[model samples]
Target: MKPKNIGIQMTDKALLFINGVPPENLPDTINYSLIACSDGAFHYLKEKGFPLEKLDFISGDFDSHSGKDETIYHEKFIFTPDQNKTDFEKSLEIIKERGYKEVDVYGGSGGEMDHFLGNLTVAFIFKDDLKITFFDDHSHYFFAPNILVLNDVKNKLISLYPFPKAENITTKGLKWSLIKENLEITNRIGTRNFAQENSVTIEFDTGNLVVFIGN
Candidate 1:
């Protein structure tokens, strides 16, 4: 199913988010028109000396704000009081609602294990609809279960992790190819694989998977 008002989903550009522990590639000027930061990340950037003026929105629960807050957005920040969804997830929803086709996520790693894993899960949650990629210090993580055709990634190290079950999977342009394998949450894991060609392809009959390609 498509998101509501699919017509509004314009612009192929990526919107950057400051989440967990951002990669060093993050620049002083993100170059994007608008940027988003989670509630706690707002404070994180404030303490770290990020130009707060560049911040367009500070999402998540308002509880993260502390003494002598900088942005008046906190007075009217996009506060999501729900505790069920992670703050990152809340940010993703707002991005999608704004009609962005892709979101470049950073800061979901190099910290708490739960935060890292939870951040990874956000990819799976919106895999079918949004083109979301998580960036760590090392690799770019893809959390989609679609027709995989990656270019200029040959000879790069790649790994796959299944959510619950990914069936009848086939691969090409990989150092090790799977003819028709079952990559499940249980045994028969898929990781530490490498791409063998400039354009690698992966096709699966069913289920979602996380694809992590080394930078």
Candidate 2:
């Protein structure tokens, strides 16, 4: 098993960019099976010269992009104007429809705090259906499954946040490990913890758990 969050080296995963802070650098397009960005993220991709031709599609309401660029990329545009869903959520739907199961997301954090939180919400909504991992300059986060094994993460910062509450949680290879403990947003939360070994295993019984691993 390889380290999942520490690197974005998987060739079978889909790559997605949202309308938050642009990534420090773009990942090699060849490493991804498919690549896409929300309409609001297109400007940053264009400004950063991210090889728009490599994108499989760009999906959103198109409010952030209009006129010239829109006309130029007409063939690549996937218009999703549903007011009920966020662009991030809509993009994930499109990705799923295209038969991609795993996605690596950039620009999912570091803009409006609400958007960051909202993105997490959408991620949680699709947690059972898709393997979505969010990447920022600082770290990578994802909704943890019942059993997760993280390799090569010794001495790195690890945080476990309960989406509201989690039950019967157990962890190994953490400096401060939890054994059948419960974490709650309103009560006890786990953050600023460090891995004690090269590999870490987390097991939990119920509720949503978001795990953040430092880059």
Candidate 3:
């Protein structure tokens, strides 16, 4: 089932595929306002027999997309050769330009560890501007807001990672609940925790908190 979250259910939600490990299952594209992918990811979608006509745009440097592939989808390609920004970031910029505030990303994990870390950094940069959630074979994660509520999470492996640090955290429905506790990367961090109830609530006063819900 599709993960039911306010961020993902928001209007004008976009679906984006990047260059990493492809998702095991492709989500229903009809649920999104727009569907897009990076150049490297397009090959997978094509190989998987995904309907190319449904794709709104394909953004990347197009370093690998050439010859026949380029000719066929030339009109749909948004050539962004900026060496300074990753293709994932460039795609997010395009999504933002199209007035999309929320996006569900696939292929954002696995593969190269450095790329995975870089993707997380990109997500952190756009935390305020975009409601971004990443889905992989293992789990789905997003940068949690001050007041966050998750449903249908009973006994799920839930992790609260401090992007750098978080303060005044209060949580409910977790096996080991935190009451006004602080978390820091260099100090203490919350990881490998489980939900005690079907619904969980997490509240923090400051700092970025990344919530990972095991699938």
Candidate 4:
């Protein structure tokens, strides 16, 4: 769904969204500075009893959304006409324009498989510019490039799946560890690995490898 790496001043938090609002997996409490709604997700929030008054921005092309609720936050709406990008992509642009470095996305899962996979691409697009976590109620996914050391991972399950390809990958502090190995899509994957210690480490020389440490 949406996902992490943490440790920042409490004041410097992230933008939280419900999907179309954009995606993330954030802590329960951290001063949420802004809230966003993407495309049709605006209506999803409304149906679920989200306080529409606190909605700060709405981003997307709005082709799939019914405009009946547009009047609620019309002033906050942003339209990106590019058909190539998804609503989440459109929202991230607004997030960057407003100078936010982190975003936590909720929802955007349990729909179509292609759309869900398309949503995952946002992490690759913004991995260098912004730290975005695409999280639903259950799953947490984050991009791990170069090196990743996760703490507080006592007994959770972790998986290393590459975005097409990753090179010279290595790992430590898990039930199984890799040393200067390679992980490729379809050909080979390191999945169902356990975090044996309190901390787990991963290293890669090139490519985007997403580490999924989940319950």
Top lDDT prediction, candidate number:
3
Candidate 1 has its poorest 10 consecutive residues by lDDT at 1-10
- Candidate achieving higher TM-score, 2 or 3: 3
lDDT of 3 by residue, 92-115 (tens): 999998888899999999999999
Stretches of candidate 1 above 4 Å error? Answer: 1-18, 27-31, 70-76
Model 3 spans with C-alpha error above 4 angstroms: 1-10
Residue 89 accuracy (lDDT) in model 2: 96
lDDT of each: 0.74, 0.91, 0.92, 0.73
Cα-based lDDT at residue 109, candidate 1: 81
- List, residue by residue over 1-215, the lDDT tens digit for candidate 2: 23233556656679999999999987766667788999989999999988888788999878777689778899999999999999999999999987888999999999789999999999988987899999988999999999999999998999999999999999999999999999999999999999989999999999889999998
TM-score for all predictions?
0.83, 0.92, 0.94, 0.83
- Look at candidate 1 and tell me the lDDT of residue 106: 72
> Model 4, which residues run further than 4 Å from truth?
1-10, 16-30, 63-68
Clashing residue pairs for model 1: 20-107, 21-107
Tell me the TM-score of model 4. Answer: 0.83
